[model samples]
Target: MKKKIKLTVWMITISLLIAAVLFVLQQHSFSMTEQKIEIDTPQGQLTGTLVLPESYSGTVGLVVFVHGDGPVNDTYDDGYKPLWEKLASAGYASLSLNKPGIGGSSGNWLEQSMEDRAQETIYAINWAKALPMIDAQAIGLWGASQAGWVIPKIVKKVPDLAFSILVSPAIQWISQGQYNTRQEMILEGFSEKEIKKREDYNAQILLLLKEQASYESYLRIAQSDDLISKEKWGFFSKNYQSDASEDLKNFTTPVHLVLGGQDINVDVEETERIYREKIPKNLLSVFYLPDADHSMLSKKNASSPLRTYLTAVFFPRHIVVEQYLDDLVHFVSQF
Candidate 1:
């Protein structure tokens, strides 16, 4: 009886081991090949990854990724790989560059203006166009959040680009900031009085930015523990007046504008309205994901820290709304 019990336990352990191995394989295995690539630009060397379909022959379409905000690496900590895999399955390759000061890249992203970022993206596009494996005619732009300001600048300069994908992009810097503050405060259950107070404070900060106040001058007024870093203040001061309306009018290529209903970061309604007003109907397509949030994560998953953590660990690829991925692949397939 003892020997029989021991044998049963051993069999169970082996089965569990096999299940774990399969899980790892399923998580890591993708229908794409990735290689580290470096590009030299006037600013510095950009460290990134070039992801391509595993079975593709000859040149394929390329999607150059522009990071939204913050210090993000090439794959956004692998958050981009799932989308990369999907694009690859649709016979498109993707190139993502690490933001300056992140992932060993030289220079500071905070020191750049929207036009500076646009110039960097143009350099990346030119570099990609020279690659033998990339179809220059099919190259497009995929930008999100803060990239909204950068993409329009690129569209104005790179007239031959195939397409542009704008995800949760904001239209104006100041108005977007106001909307974000109000919406997030309400979502967090802030009372009317508290929300008003925060808005008032934000107004003061905007004034300081407009006045070109030094960091020391800002400290005298802010008086809050959550102080802005000198770098952040510089970045905000440089870009506070950015508006995309003027640049949107210059778009000569097809654009796919993605908006999330649950996004509090950008006023999606305003974004949709202005894009419609500025861009011609024939060249514009809108995808509204009602159940997705700012980052395209499902509303439920984004609401809970515990659930988000678990889902990211066990099903990293499905962290974003599944439909969002489907729509992305579908859009790319059309080209």
Candidate 2:
């Protein structure tokens, strides 16, 4: 009897290990498979990867990813795989393009304005529509951060965009930057005087930006602060002027706006306020993750802004919250 009981325990343990390995292998297979493609925009050609869901057939919906600020490459700074894989499991095809100067794409990304970026995205959408495997009428845009400025412009131009998913979108470009700065300062425990200095600094910098101040003039303003590098100044000058108030109100596209309550970047509260005011009830849907950060990762101490930032940057930041994926799946399926 004792020998029989020991054999049973061994068999159960072996079965559990085999099951775990098989599950991991299945997940690997479900991740999006890459295909090379190129799109011609007004500026130049964008070389990108069209990722199709494994086992997907019979014309799946397409999701085109736009990047946030900076030189975000085709993989969205190497943080898009999990999200894209989740979408793939839900039977969606997705594309992520290398910015003009990043991978095999053409043109200089830093020189492009919001209008230029929007045009690039439109080109990508058209390219996706032409693919034999994609449902053209069901194409949608998915992006976060600076994409908030780009996506609305896209829906405005196309007017027939199938759906959209915005994660931690900013209401407006300049205001969002200010909001980010303030939030960071508060988290770093800046004093009232220090915060006031930043506010004053933001006012002046924005004024110069609005006036289309020369790079040299911006340099003069930056001499007082070392935080603004030459690279950063160039990025701001090129992509800084955008107001989404009109676009937000006018976009009739089905929008699933996701906000992270623990996000330490943009003022999620302010963005939500604008959404409530401008977005029509029928047009807008939402998913709020109270303990998730801007990247939809679980946070240990969301209430403490400092801990939130550190966790997002250094440790355990790559774990995607399950609810974020579920929210996206529900949004995509409904539309």
Candidate 3:
């Protein structure tokens, strides 16, 4: 009788634990209503998601997300939902579109220039503004990484934007690339001599890009295993000159800049300095997260593959710095 009672208690405990896990997963969607949205642009049809507050009666303010880099899909494989949920809770709507050739969207992402990206975002903004459920005057942008090059251009064109949020944005393309390479090398324990050699190679590649050299020209000089594809080369040739300093000066809306101190991909200090020099103090707000990485993920989680996987699977919302999400909501709430 004692053995049977112990077995029953163990079974009950396991059952309750499973039930709690399921409940957490079910509630992960939070209080947001997400819908499949499609936008037609000159480039092609864009597949996207429009997330809105579940219980709001009036039109909500909208935030259109611009991807940093890569062929990212809407929601960034659900990585953006935490942010979406935060926005929803604050009575705001968020829109995110998959890059061209991704998630059934038409055209090719690598074929687009920075200007093309800005124009595509403008198209999304205009489409959202026409919806009766979104307040046109309350529309803004949230972008990161390569988006630093894109968002400022959007701000330049859309002078009346409600606000702009930039995360780990770099000021110049060439310098940012160099910084990333150096930091990554240092982290990997590369010697000074080896680092200098790689930088010299990068300089050569930059010169080729500046000269508009063809793929064949690059092939002749590139190492056998280091050759970039023609498409990637074309992308580099088109955007290697990207510098946001001039475009940032055109900002006419409130801007919130988030920088992660432990970020290796960008020189956050340089980004902050340039932003301060270019944007008026009254229009810019800065948030610095000392323990975060380029993606605003905590250094502890970002550095451990096992921890990253475990956290992403069990606590996806906490994959990034919780404070980063809170700051995003706080900044947008003011508007």
Please, what are the lDDT tens digits per residue for candidate 3 over residues 212-270?
A: 88999999889988889898998889899999989999898899999998999999999
Q: Write the per-residue lDDT of candidate 1 for residues 38-116, one digit (tens) a residue.
A: 8888778988899999987888999999999898999998889999999998999999998888887778999999999
- Name the lDDT of candidate 3: 0.92
Question: Per-residue lDDT of 1-335 in model 2, one digit per residue for the tens?
Answer: 99999999999999999987776555444356878788876677899888888886589998899888778888764467677777888888889999988897998787777778888999998888888999988889998878888888888888888988889888777777777888888888999899999799788888887887776787777746455766666778777767777778757878888999888777888887788788888888888898888767677644556765554344322456678888888788875
The per-residue C-alpha lDDT of model 2 at residue 89 equals: 81
The lDDT per prediction is 0.92, 0.80, 0.92
Q: Which candidate is the best by TM-score?
A: 1
Candidate 1's TM-score: 0.95
Checking candidate 3 for backbone clashes, the offending pairs are none
Query: Candidate 3: lDDT of 229?
Result: 89
Cα lDDT for residue 159, candidate 2: 81
